[model samples]
Target chain A: MIHFFNDIARTRLTRWVFGWLFLVLLYQWSANLMISQLESPVLLRVDLDLTYWLVHLTGIGEFFRSSYFAAFSFDFFLTVLCLVAVLFPKRTIVPILTGLFFLIYCVLLNSYQCWHYHNLITLILLIVPFCFRSLKTFSILFAGLRYAVAYIYASAAIWKLVRGSVFNEGQMKWLIQHNYVDRLAVEGYELNFLENMMFQLSNYSTLSSIALIIGVAMEASFLIAFFTRKFDRHLIIIGVVFHLITAVLVDVSFLQLWILFLVFLPPDRITSSPTTWFQRQKA
Target chain B: MNFFLRDVWKQSKIVFAFFVAFILGTIWCTFSKIEITPFFLWAHYSDKQTPTGKFERIYIKVNGEILDLPKFSRATREMIQLPTEYFVQLERTDYNTNTRQLIQKKFASMMSQKSLQKMEGHLCNSKEDKNAYLYWMAKYIERVTGKRVLTLEVGTCELLFKPDGTVARENFIFVAKFSRA
Candidate 1:
């Protein structure tokens, strides 16, 4: 079984996935900056970043304590440099910088509790470029990434299933009626186009219930990716559509998870299929 | 050719063994409440699972002006941390040591008992564990909005709904009060 798994993990497509993921990280960082302006004197002492213990032990806590702007600058600069360094994978510094950059970014994000989970998929995807060296390492990293993504989806599905609220028609209707409608009312804003749509969806309980069920089912279907490559591309498409719809309706975008889903694309088909088509056209 | 094949086989076996162990460990940790670094096994949104069925309409009054909870909640969600169970957890950890040291060293004079008490009610923790978070959160609001938050009051309205989607009852819960001198 181990030998069989090794064969399954071998791929020439890993590098492309690496490139795609790096691009997504840049977008994630940019979106975060746009949403939450990390201004100068952006005080860091308040929140529990989990990096405090390590910083204290190393006697370098002072550097992070004050000069909030400096911390943000260093994090952003290192992230940019790491993205550039990724293209030069042969250099030893590339991997080192990748690891260092990821650590800094994690610490910076952990300062805010809500933002901690935003880029989790990106962090997991980074293991490939940061950890693997020779071709032999590819199998291990691919296996790890595959399992990590699968586990995230599976765990979410299991959680929803156990909760039972996801299956109950009340969950979506409740969210729409209570959180959004009440929130809009308190904010003194009339229900605009999207909000009105959500309200209408809530009015038709059956539609919202069906939407919620499909969403949960789509998440649950990710388990198939772990066991077999079949339907992987189709699942990625479903995931993308699902995220796009949610982004429109709820203003919640899971772009990071969407990019990570690109890993499920069959690498050989992606890289070679175009060229194969061209050759067939000529013949 | 033979030597090359043998080396590949050996490497593959080693890598595959490690992968197997990791997969098994992640599966095990999913069911158990264990915190491990670099390998987070669970992605359970606990809040979603156990539905409270109450829409939290929280309002805060800083100084003499009233701050709307919905707008406050939105802004806080984007910029400042919202007062969720997650925020409380963050408070518990940061207040363990660094916050007190920070207050004593630099922010001692700025501290106010009224504000501290008010912030305490928002967090689900002990008095000692509460001070650092409350003080910092108060200071954070001041810095971010450039508003002098003299006194703070948090009021929560638990809005329930009937099965047919009509409003059931709005129960107002006054949670906290803080004053900074």
Candidate 2:
């Protein structure tokens, strides 16, 4: 059964779903998060990023923290150039992909206290590197960070679900309403149109409930995506669009950070086709 | 002093030296938490006066990339959590270019259309009708920024700095635009 599992439907679906995410999403994610952090109370307010304050104050920051980001950026920049130089070889691309995710994890642990979505993506990014045999350094870092992101994603999603927040239609409405109304389009700010959509939609609680259900689906799908790249790819787009909708409408700005993992894996590959795989298994 | 040095040596000395460097880097140098806080202040007050100049985020496409740079928000700083600072498209053309024609035009158009869109509304609500709209944005920003025209290739959001560099524009989203080198 396991041997027969590999098929075009699964592969193609997976490829279609995840392609843009795994290739194009990582840089934006890190850029979004790092930029956001740079503008945070911890960094901008106190004049210290996580590396400067957290890691340095605690332990790792002493040597690897301060110039780490700068060096890492330079390193990443070089790796990318090399990839371009080599005409995007999988060998070169994969290693760099793996390393970038590992770096994301280090940055997150250093900066924020909570294991937020930022941490989760950082973790997810390291998976491919772990799978590569010859690249031990990349593998080790990937394994550690992947575990971190997976753990954080699961824990947080569960927490939000349990609190009646993630699934609550009323809360979702509040989020929508809070984001919409006169405050939303206030003087032509961002998300003005999204605010308009939410406002128009929120008048009916039933529609509001559907929006809530969409949220649940999105959160639930996020978990599934982690295990399977197809779902991950599809959901990353949904997640980003949703966040973009919200960010514009409500002022949340972590779209790239939240969906960073779409960068690795065959985003368009599917594990199986619902009908064909099922029929074959049945036969 | 000898005893202290010896203690330092006992702990991973390599680790300890690195630690000191980290501390000095954080403590000695300074950075700023920049958002559109000042921009908001400007917009809110200007809204009270000029009626059309309130802080805002406008979406535009450079070449073909869709962009959104939210420069407005309603929440006060203390009431918010997480990094609201956005990772947006960067600006190119050497700081303030005196001769970037396309850029200046795009900027002006954005400044104007920002009014037509909501405070940070959908990035590209109507894609097909945007050529004239975009050209106008570049035209206006160029008009406002300077005289000479410059060919440009950078994606950046407007940043409003406080005199002291504390809060940036709050309650808004940063845009995303792929930069081409």
Candidate 3:
């Protein structure tokens, strides 16, 4: 474990992961999706998740929801912790606290939104390995994280197959019409390039069914990762393309989940050169 | 893989235990059709959907002006849509009384009456709850649009999907309306 931690390659990977996460935090804040910008939202719905029920029943969640100052302070503290974790990549405690606070933020946000959005799940899982200082531990957790991502996609495909949705010819056409009814109903509501393409594709049953099969096939492709690492880069590309297609067609942005792609980065490819004092010491 | 697992077991028993638990929990959740956070059912878009010909869409009008929700950002759109959908669901379920009764009949053996009551209390959705949500939504719309909302009207518009790839809006039914004094 010590030998693995002392290696410069692992240090570069650690810095890169935290650096990417810090950027995601900044983007979320600017988009008004951060906890501080929520302005003491009123909780409307809670999921069946026991943790969610406990937080609300214990009044801990209500305390944060009713007080803007407390929520803002919490967000500020979390941001500081993330920044510290990024600056000092070797510090285990900071990432651990960051992960805990971010998990709370995700649960509260979902409760307030009255819906379960799975986009941030990837970010939450990616933060786990950073909480451990040992590279051996990191590798184990990172490998597990990779499999988790693969399972998410592979399982989604399996569900579709098991439920026989993939065989339904009208499934994608109906989904497109249902999801975009508002846009389609509005007169002269301009559709973007991708939206226009999807709408056009939905016009023909054969075309729409083909698109649906292609999507399921792409998801099923992740099953290969569990068997071999040779196609990791290819899997990374497929993941990005899948998300892009979902974002444009369904209007669900899984951009935050893209952080999990960092898991595919081989340690040697993480950095071209080690320029930091920590790397120098390791060398 | 064997070497990695051996190393994980030797280096950190806690992480190894967590991995075992996670794997087992994921399988259980998959089969039992329940989500326990961290372990989730990724069955999104898996349901077989058929063409209903007509679909009901929630429409929001602020200060007598129709609000185009698709024009807003994703976060803003969700903020406006999800709670309104929840409100509509509550109305359809008769303020959750029907749903509560259904659950009571279905899971009476698994859950105690006191536990069932506790669940019902957490999900209490009376008319007052609807009003509170409407009030909050009105303010949220004002904040997002930067326009003071004198009146907020929440309604459902039935959209008819034509076979020729065109959609027409049909009956607009008022579900709820809130006015600020």
Candidate 4:
């Protein structure tokens, strides 16, 4: 088992995958750490995670005291270790340690009820080391990652359809007024292009209908990959454009989703492009 | 320590089946409206439907002074950084507390009688509840302003919209308050 895993880890594709996961973790962790540092420290420091509860559960709750500083320090250390593990993948055990530390971090976040669905992508990273042990396992895990992406979109589209009025012009107006405007008003910001567009299109049923249809189609586009991988790039492009449009229209940013979509881009394609270009230039 | 790839292939098949089942179950649950544990895959599908066209302003006070809580303010920006629903729910739960009521009264005392009269809704209804929200706010303000806050207050400035694009603006009205317990 050890030999099989080490052999697979040495591969260029496995290295590239780990590198991508590391980047995602680094970006997310660093951004979160920075923001938390700048924010009001009031109850934030007092907020306890599972580690605290676990200590208490074992009858040592008195001895296992934790504060915000402990949580912040642990997370910051894990973030640094994750980057180090990626850089020194030759120490295969380091990557595993990074994954384990991250799992612990996730547990702590959950204790605070702060865990979100997107955090599951980190679970994929945790399994990466184990999954790459052999060709068959690698294939299964790769496909599983792709399925996770598709599931996110399909489920979102289904929920919207269930809501029934998401396609209506009035629905668009409600969204703009209640969410975007109310939020912006609190922050003393003016409307942006997306808000302006929603306002103008709110009274036009036909245009709103077209916009709604396009949104659903874009979200559900990943379903095509389930049938065949023929149009993966097109699917990814559509997803990117959709997210970018939403980022502008509403203050909500799905930047992490963009990173997850990289699973659709074959590692060889990404790795080979720079080498192939250099070879052509040399020729 | 090399193993036969055939064994790996068989194991992979089981894993693949598990993935398929999980994905299918999630989709099925969405349609069936069945309760799912952990709720890690909601995809932000909650309806965002709300009446538009009204302008609103939320204000925050620490101690006796009102602070800039507009979008550019660090405190407001950080609070909104949480999920939209979570932020709103936190406010709803936090505002109806004993310390918040004291802060609300402090806000009323600071305001002119005419301004207090114009204020609509019960800011703090002399109700005594838990002090968790106030403690949190004091801690928050101490961190932001680098001083221990003795009291805090919150207010909202609302503007009602007319059909003709005209707005009837209301000045700052007390919403809730927090004080050190």
Candidate 5:
């Protein structure tokens, strides 16, 4: 087992990963997605998830929801842990603890919001490879994570294919109408350019169908990563474009999941000097 | 495949085991329609959608002023909209009694009666749940908008796309009001 602390390259890459993860956390905090900002929510939506039910039954959920002090304290502790992990990326325990706390945060936030916010799944899982300090172990786990991200997109495309929704001409039109009709209908409310374009597209079935097919094709392209790493850069571009289109048209922001794209960056490139990073990308 | 089985197993048995377990668990969850977090089905937007002639819209009025949800940030907007929509949906279904019954009937052979009852208790909504949700929602609104919510009204209305490329509100399903003391 190669010690990551002794390897400057792996250490630098780990720090780079943690730095971006911290920035994502800071953005989430600013967006009021943090527990302190949520205050102490009284209601917990357990849904059908057995793990959630266990949390509710064990009084752990109640402990967080019933006391703002407890919730805020946990949030502060989690932030501190994440900061420590970012600073000392060589410490194996810090990332492990941060990952565990982040899991609890994801579950609690979803319970409070009464919705299963799955976009955070990428962020949560991406923290796992950093928990290992063994260079070989970290590399293998990181490779697994890369495959997992590709699987997410590829499986989504497969689902659409299996469910026969890919062939439905009205699918995209209905989705746009369902998402934007209320906003467009609100009198005196100004519609932005993207919203206007989406509304116009909703009225035209052919245009919307073409957009949906393009989306499916983009998702399907992730399958290429499983076969070869040569097209990883192209996959990253497609992933970003896909998420951007969804954000603009459906108002769903999966930008946080973009952190997973870091996996596509070769470890050597990540470990390279920061000033040369842009130059390397251009090359 | 040979490299994975030989080298990965030799280097780290734990990582090898974890990969195997996660792959199997994800496959099972995907096929069984169960999501045990981290092992999601990833079947989002997979089902076909068709126009129902009307779109149901949730409207929230805080301190007698209706909220333009599109004006807020995505996170804030979801924080406000998701719970309100869920609450209204539960109200329509009588706090999920219908859902509970269906679950009980479907899983009768799979789960014990006591376990099913406990699940029902956790899943079902009550008047107290509604009150708690309202209180938390009011506080969240206050925190986000920096306005003390004196009165909050949540309602749902149907929106119809007219022939002339315009949308009109058809009729309100219901409206619930609450006041913070």
Candidate 6:
């Protein structure tokens, strides 16, 4: 961070963070205009949505039309502005002016939800070019982030294999038992042979008992993949594959964000052409 | 120098606190009360209705022949009202304050079997005809060899007859559930 104040990161951090923030903001604003219901059931995953409401609650209810639109925009827009103040680095996480704007937006919006994937990832990408300036803090912070990502993956895998999910009779059966989707897909209500076979096999005491063993193995391996040196590539490849299948069948977008975390590691994590888990694990 | 306000965003605490507050407040507003409206619609399956009375047979004139038959039926007719409970049949063995009328009516109707004259019949399809027929049956008697109908205000059931007091026809016991105007 100290080095960032000097010539080390003055130009890089400012350009990177601000550019990403502005570009994303531009896209979101335009998209929001076209689809009017973007805010109702909350079509987008926005953490600072409360700002939209404070515009209605306080006396300045018509804030969107006049009183507070600029102020509201500045809440996030100024976070981007902090990249400019990064040059000063006067014992400030971000500069004072940017901070004041954030404060006003926070008070008005009352936004409490902490940073989710969108904010965190975008912020990281914006700051990465500057991170090289402080190798020690940069390495340690990146390591911690890497561990956090691994934890998220392990938790997800654990949650899935719990009594109701992949390891047990509950979720698989819940999926097969529902007739509505099958009916829609096939023009009539009938469980496919593959699904039925899975159901019957799952119900057997022998199969259910084995599933618990397999589940523990998968979850443990997914967690260990990040820490272990010997089988890191093998384990990570398997974890990524499992994640892809989960994304397709269960439709959880947050987990897709998780796949990005694995990319944070040194290129040696997989030793291949930098992508595609489908190919054999080389590194 | 406006140190605190100017430098507040530098404090993870203020940012943290504000961020937390903002998230929670937004959730609270999102979860606020939603209005629910009440609704009503018409229903199905109505019941039969009649009035109340207790009377016995004074004479026995069957098939236009005078006979010394005392096996009589004293029927009761209770008027139709909203939300009736149940139809009751009682004998001396089971008679109580509430059921005494049913018991007495049962015995009197049994012992006072006298004259019965069949009138014009009713079709089963129409609801109006069913109520009218049940009401009219309370006024007169009909012994069509196979069926004996005993109906009044509360409910309708049938009694079968043999010379020695045995049921000869299938008895239909109907407890009407609802009555629509």
Best by lDDT: 5
Docking tier of model 5: it is: medium
> TM-score of every model?
0.69, 0.38, 0.88, 0.67, 0.89, 0.34
Q: Roughly what TM-score does model 1 have, to 2 decimal places? A: 0.69
Candidate 5 C-alpha lDDT tens digits along A1-283: 2122236766766676677767767877888888778867654566666656555566665677667788788878787786787678789998898888788888878877788778774577788877777777787887778788999899999999999898897898888887777676778766778678777888788888999999999999998877677788888889998998988777765877887887776656666677798886799
lDDT per residue for candidate 3 within B94-152, as digits (tens), equals 77554356556766789898977776555444666666777778777877778888998
Write down the lDDT that model 1 would get. Answer: 0.53
Per-residue lDDT value at A257 in model 5: 82
Ordered list by TM-score, greatest first: 5, 3, 1, 4, 2, 6
Stretches of model 2 off by over 4 angstroms after superposition: A1-120, A123-131, A134-157, A166-169, A180-194, A221-283, B1-69, B72-181
lDDT of each residue in A72-146, candidate 4, tens digit only: 565576667656655664555655666665555443333222223343334544245343344556555655566
lDDT of 1 by residue, A81-168 (tens): 5555545544445556666655555544443333345444245454553455555465445534654676667677777777676777
Task: Please tell me which predicted candidate would have the highest TM-score against the true structure.
Answer: 5
lDDT values of the candidates? 0.53, 0.36, 0.76, 0.50, 0.77, 0.32
What does candidate 5's lDDT look like per residue over B123-164, in tens digits?
556666777777778888888888899988889978898887
Q: Report chain A TM-scores, every model.
A: 0.75, 0.48, 0.88, 0.70, 0.90, 0.46
Docking category of candidate 6: incorrect
True contacts kept of each: 0.12, 0.00, 0.47, 0.18, 0.59, 0.00
Please write out the lDDT profile of model 6 over residues A1-283, one tens digit for every residue.
Answer: 1111333333433443344444543443332210111111101111223333233234231233243344346444564665455444432345344444433332222211111223223233223323343443333333334434444446545545442344443433233222112122222234457534544543454554454345445655657644443454565566666555433332222331333444343433333332643454553
Residue ranges of candidate 1 with Cα displaced over 4 Å: A1-63, A67-70, A114-118, A177-182, A248-251, A269-283, B1-11, B41-53, B62-79, B83-135, B138-155, B159-181
lDDT, candidate 5, at A165: 93
Interface CA root-mean-square deviation for model 4: 9.9
* Comparison by TM-score, 1 against 5, better one: 5
lDDT of 6: 0.32
Show the lowest summed lDDT stretch of 10 residues, model 2 chain B. Answer: B37-46
Candidate 2 lDDT over A1-283, as tens digits, reads 0111123432332233234334433543333333222222121111113322232333332223245465356445533542342343334444455445444434443333211233223333423433343333332333223223433334444545555555454555455544442233334444445455665565566776676566545545555533544353465466667666656544665543553443333312234446855787699
The regions of model 6 sitting more than 4 angstroms off are A1-68, A71-133, A160-166, A175-217, A225-227, A255-259, A262-264, A267-283, B1-181
- Model 6 chain B TM at 0.17
